[model samples]
Target: MSSMSARRGSRIGRGMAWAILIAAVLVTVFPFYWMVRTALTPAGDLFADSHALWPHHPTLINFKRVLGMTSAERARAAGGSGAQINFLWYTLNSIIYSAVIAIAQTFFCAMAGYAFARLRFPFRDALFGILVAALMVPPIFTLLPNFTMVKNLGLMNTFFGLVAPSVLMTPFAVFFLRQFFLSIPKEVEEAAVLDGVGRWGAFWRIIVPMSRGPLITIGLTTTVWAWKDYLWPLLVGRGEHTRVLTVALGVFLQQSPNTQPDWTGLMAGSTLSVLPVLVLLIFLGKRLVQSLNFSGIK
Candidate 1:
């Protein structure tokens, strides 16, 4: 009788776990579903009293206007006068900004992390502690200083200004990579040394290859952060020439002349903006999971 009760309790616990997981999935996915649904629904039908879960009248009008494929009259009606900023160009800028930051952060952070893990030098721990401490500092606090530094360097409105401050490395990336590097066995490096492999060669050929998972994780994270960043880019990248997707989306939201926000176009633009990051995660997410599992990062 006791064994049967134990089995029944286990089944109930498993059922509750599955129920919780399904609820969590719904909570997470519903927003994306709503965004896409709104994007598909014609602007006229969106506010109708009898709104359907699926779009009643599916239309590409919102996407067409956002993508600049619609007639000039239609574009003007939907996006207003300030919609002159090209959506595709803004997307391109985001891609460039995110890609450069990701590559630079991954390489530099890996080098810094390896040094902290393996190299001996004066004030090494102290310096690393400072770097780690920076993780606790709110990014908002540094905005003024970074803006001043960028202005002093005469990099405003340039791609360099957008990329320079953040592209090099980040505190979190360094800390994360350092932790991963610490988990590596020193015997591997010693064996490489015994085989006459110099430190640089060993790092490049062995350590980097072995650390691919962590590197990918850092790169993906940096890329996503850079892509979503709006404040810094908006501050420095003032002109359409340097505008990124997030800033452009904000601009789009405000482009409505009469203060009536173009909900349909906004939803369409949002859906488009989210696609690149989603595709990136879909492709690289497995590597991230593998890295976390391999590194015992749970």
Candidate 2:
């Protein structure tokens, strides 16, 4: 009788867990579903059925309109404002902006982390403590100072201005890599030193190879953050040559002919903007998860 009750309780617990998982997935996926559904929907039909699970008359016309493939008349007819978004150019800009920050930050932060973990410099602990404390300060507080410095250097409306503040490293990133570096055994470095390897050689040849997991993970995360960043880009990347996808979206939002915005075009643009990030996550997701787990263990 006791065994029967325990089995029943286990079943109940399993059912509850599945229910929670399903609910969480639905909550997470519903927004993406709605975005795609709205993008496929004719603007005229948007108000006709506000609670639709899918569009009745799905079309790719919105994509054409957003990509500037459709004629202005055709775009207007399809419920677009006909303001052409330089989608390809903006995408390239976003890629460049994100790539620079991710690659540079990862390399530099790893070095800083190695120094904090292994090197014996004066006031090292105090400096590291200050860095860790920086993680607690809101990023907004630093924005004005960063902007002023960039502007004073005549870097406004340039990619350099957009990426300079974050390209080197962030405190949390250094701290995270430092913790992971601390987990690596000192014997590994000692062996490399006994083989005539210097500090730089040991770091590059031994430590870096072993720390590939964390590096990849941090690189992916930093890329995503830079890609999605809007405010900083909007401020500094306002020129046609430097404008990123997020800023382009803001431009699209304001370019409507009428008071009502181009909902279809906006959604289409959003979908296009998100595709690259989705593909990146899909391919690197396993590594990211493994790295995170490894970092956690460390």
Candidate 3:
């Protein structure tokens, strides 16, 4: 019958959807699996078999070298710089950079979003339109001007330099939070005003609490972006005192000349660098999801 054929077609479509989802997951997760496998594999056994799905002789030697546990003579022989590699310092810098940028951007963006959503002022729409327009501007276009400004301000090689250009809310962040703010009921703010709460008090006690989901979402997103950023930090924080994990990894790659890449150490460093973000998502991912659902983003 026609009904039976339609039911069978629906079942086939559902099966195809599930198949696509599984394939997507595998494609995304395979790289991480390969990185971890290579990190654990012994250097001697890495290229012995090129089609390995798992290490034949797993070892922690790569991790040890990355953590600076190898003897100085061995490190030197491996073509590493004689200077002690301090991965811990690089990690700390990365943490500080991401955290500061996230907090600053979240707070400032919330303030701007609320203003754009609720406050009536001259040229308000025009100003917001400008922000929206800025979203279309490529970040690379601003790099030269930002670099020149930083140099003029003598901020190079400082944490301030790393955070300066992006410390405030981004245009996209402002737009996102503004949309969330617009979804809030104006009656809530009016009620707070009737209770003698000033604008600032109402914003802090009511709007902020109601907007917690969007704020947290923005904070997490900004943190991840800052953590992964390479070019800006590479340009501004060139000194050892200010270098972050990504820069340090790049330096590690170039520490020796005319030698085979330190595939094991590189993989080990990469694995360690990704741990913080992975752990963060593991702990906060549920909260982020709940917030997104509550915010009616879909």
Candidate 4:
């Protein structure tokens, strides 16, 4: 009888855990479903069922307007602002901004991290401590100074200006890579040195290949951050040459002269903005998980 009760209790616990997981999944996924639902909905049918699981009249017209395929009159009739937003151009700008930051920051951070982990120099520990401490400082605190510097350099509305602030490295990236580098066996580099390889060669040939997982992890994180960043880009990249998708979405939201905002079009733009990150996460997410699970630094 006691054994039967224990088995029943275990079953109950497992059922509760599954229930909680399903609830969490619903909470996370429902917003995306709602966004897509609203995007698919026609302007007239939007208010007909606020709690709808699907739109009454599903159409691609909202996407057409957002992509500049529809005429201004048609877009207005479909409850969109008649502005011809250059969504493709903005997307390209976002790609460039994100790619530049990710590649440059990852390479520099790996070098810095390798130096901090391997090289012996004066005040090395103190300098690394200072870099780690820098992680405590909020990014917003530095925004004004960075903005001022960029403005002084007259890099506004340029890709260089958009990427300059994050192009080098972040304290967190350096710290993260350093911890991983510390876990690597020094004998590997020693073996390379014995083979007549120099420090730079050992780093490039041995350390880099060994650290590919962590490097890719850092690169993906930087890309996602640069893609979603809005404030700095809004301040520095307001020009047509460099405006990213996030800033363009904001501008599109406000372009409507009507009292009611263009909900469908705005949601469509948001859906487009979310796609690249979503696809990225889908493909590389497993590698990111594996990198984090590596038995280093623990």
How many clashes in each structure?
A: 0, 0, 0, 0
Best by TM-score: 4
lDDT of 1 at 241: 90
Tens-place lDDT digits, model 3, residues 139-162: 989998999999899999998888
lDDT of 1 by residue, 108-197 (tens): 999999999998899999999999999998999998999999999999999999898888889988888888889899998878977988
- TM-score of model 4 relative to the true fold? 0.93
Q: Candidate 2 lDDT, tens digit per residue, 68-146?
A: 7878899889887756566778889999999999999999999999999998899999999999999988988999888
What's the lDDT of the predicted structure labeled candidate 3? 0.85
Candidate 1 backbone collisions, by pair = none
Q: Candidates ranked by lDDT, best first?
A: 4, 2, 3, 1
Over 86-199, each residue of candidate 4 has an lDDT whose tens digit, in order, gives 677888899989999999999999999999999888999999999999998998999999999999999888888888878998999999999999989999998887799878
- Candidate 4 regions off by >4 Å? 291-298
Off by over 4 Å in 3: 1-17, 76-83, 256-259, 287-298
Candidate with maximal lDDT: 4
TM-score of each: 0.88, 0.90, 0.87, 0.93
* Residue 263 CA displacement from its true place in model 2, Å: 1.4
Candidate 1 residue 83 Cα shift, in angstroms, is 2.5
The lDDT of model 2 is 0.87
List pairs with backbone clashes in candidate 3: none
Clashing pairs in 2: none
